[model samples]
Target: MNANKTLAIGCILGALAVMTGAFASHGLKAHLSSYALSIIHTGVQYQFWHALALVGLGSAMLRFPSRRLGRASLLMIIGTIFFSGSLYGLAITGMKWLGPVTPIGGVLLILGWFTAAWSFWRPDTDSVKA
Candidate 1:
C-alpha cells in the first residue's frame, strides 16, 4: 500500500489497540475467565506493539519510500488484524476454531519484523537511510 494509506491504517490500528486495552482492563475482566483475559492480554500486547511498528513503518516510508518497507508494513497490518482479531473473537465468543488462526498471525508478525530488518540490506535506492 501507499504511504498515506499505510499511515492512516497505522493510526487506526493504534487507536484500536488502546481501545481494546481499555476494554480488556475495565469491561472484559468482569465477564472473562482468567485464561480468556490472558488471551486478550497477549493479543493486546502484540497488537499495541505492532500498531506502533506500523506507524513507524509508515513514517519511515514517507522519508525513504521503500517497497520492502511497504511490504513489511503490510505484513504487520495483516498480523495485527488476524492475531488480535482472533483473540478478541475467541475470548468474547468462546469459539475454539479461531485458535488455529492466531499462530498464523504470529508467524506473519515474525515475518514482518524480519522483513523490516532485511529492508536495511535490500533497500530501495530512494530510501533515506540507505
Candidate 2:
C-alpha cells in the first residue's frame, strides 16, 4: 500500500487500540473473566505497538519510498487484524477456534519487523541510503 494509506490505517488502528483498552478496562471489567481481560489487554498492547510502527513506516516512506517498507506495513496491518482481531473475538465470544490464528499473526508480526529492518539495512533504488 502507499504511504498515505499506511498512515491512515495506523491512525485508525491506534484509535481502536485506545478504545479497546478503555472498553476492556471499564465496560468489560466486571463482565469478563481475568483471563479474557488479559487476552484483550495483550491484543491492545500488540496492536498499539504495531500501529505506532506503521505510523513510523509511513513517515519514513514519505521521506524515502521503499517497496520493502510497504510490504512491512501490509504485513503489520494484516497481522494486527489476525492477532488482535482473533483475541477480541475469542475473548468476547468465547470462540476456541480463534486461538489457533494468533500464532500465525505473531509470525507475521515478527516477519514484518525483520523485513522493515532489512529494508533499512539495504536500501533499494527507490529508497534513500541509510
Candidate 3:
C-alpha cells in the first residue's frame, strides 16, 4: 500500500482506539466488573501502542517504501485486530475461547517488530550515500 493509504488507515485506527478506550472508561466502567475492566484496559493499552506503531510504519513507508516495512505494518494491523479485538470481545462477552487467539496475535506483533527492524537495518537503495 501507498504511504498515504497507510497513514489514513493508521489515523482511523488511532481514532477508533481512543474512542474505544473512552467508552470503556466512561461507559463501561460501572457496568463491567473489576476483572473485565482490567481486560478492557489491557486491550486499550495494546491498541494504543499499536496505533503509534502504525503511524511510525506509515512514516517509514513514506521515507523508504520497503516491502519488509509494508509487511510489518500489515502484521501490526492484524495483530492489533486479533489481540486487542479478541480481548475486547472476551471482556465484554465473557467468551473463554477468544483467549487462545490473543497469543497468536502477540506472536504476529513480535514478527512485525522483527520485520520493521530488518527494514531499518537494510541500506536505503533510493538514497545517495556520501
Candidate 4:
C-alpha cells in the first residue's frame, strides 16, 4: 500500500467504524439481540483501532519509508476487513459460517504487528530523521 492510499483507506475505515458503532448503540439496540449488538461493538472497536494504525503507518512512512511498513498496513487492512467484517456479517445475519474467518483475521492482525516491528528495525534511512 502506498502511503497516501493507506492513509485514505484508514480515514475511510475510521469514519465507517464510528458510523457502525453509533448505529449499533442507538439504532440497532432495539432491533438486535444483546449478543449480536455486543459482537458488532467488538468489531467496531477493532476496526477503529486498526484504522488508526493504518493512519499511523502511513504517516510514519513520510519519515521512515519501507516496503515492510506498507506490508504492515496491508495486513492491518486485510485483518480489519476479515476480523471486523466477519463479525459485522455474523451479527447482522446470524450466520455461523463467518465465525471461522475471525481467527484468520486475528492471525493476520498478529502478523501485521510483527511486520511493524520489523519496519522499525529497518526503516529506509534516507527517509528517516537524523
Candidate 3, residues 1-130, lDDT tens digits: the string is 5567667778888898889989989999999999998998898889888888889888978777777777888898899899999999999999999999999999999999998888889847432222
lDDT of 2: 0.94
Best by lDDT: 2
Which segments of model 2 are wrong by more than 4 Å? 125-130
Error of 2 at 118 (Å): 1.0
Error of 4 at 116 (Å): 0.8
| Global CA lDDT computed for model 4 | 0.90
Better model by TM-score, 1 or 4? Answer: 4
Candidate 1 versus the native: TM-score? 0.90
Off by over 4 Å in 3: 124-130
Which pairs of residues clash in candidate 3, taking residues 3 or more apart in a chain or in different chains? none
Q: Which lDDT value does model 3 have at 53?
A: 86
RMSD versus native structure for model 4? 2.6
Better lDDT candidate (3, 4): 4
Give one digit per residue, the lDDT tens place, for model 1 in 10-124: 8898888889889888997889999998888888888888888888888878877887888888898998899999999999999999999999999999999998888877775
CA displacement after TM-score superposition, residue 75 of candidate 1 (Å): 0.7
Cα deviation at 94, candidate 2, in Å, is 1.0
Per-model TM-score on C-alpha atoms:
0.90, 0.94, 0.91, 0.93
33-88 per-residue lDDT for model 2 (tens digits): 99999999999999999999999999988888898999999999999999999999
Task: State the TM-score for model 3.
Answer: 0.91
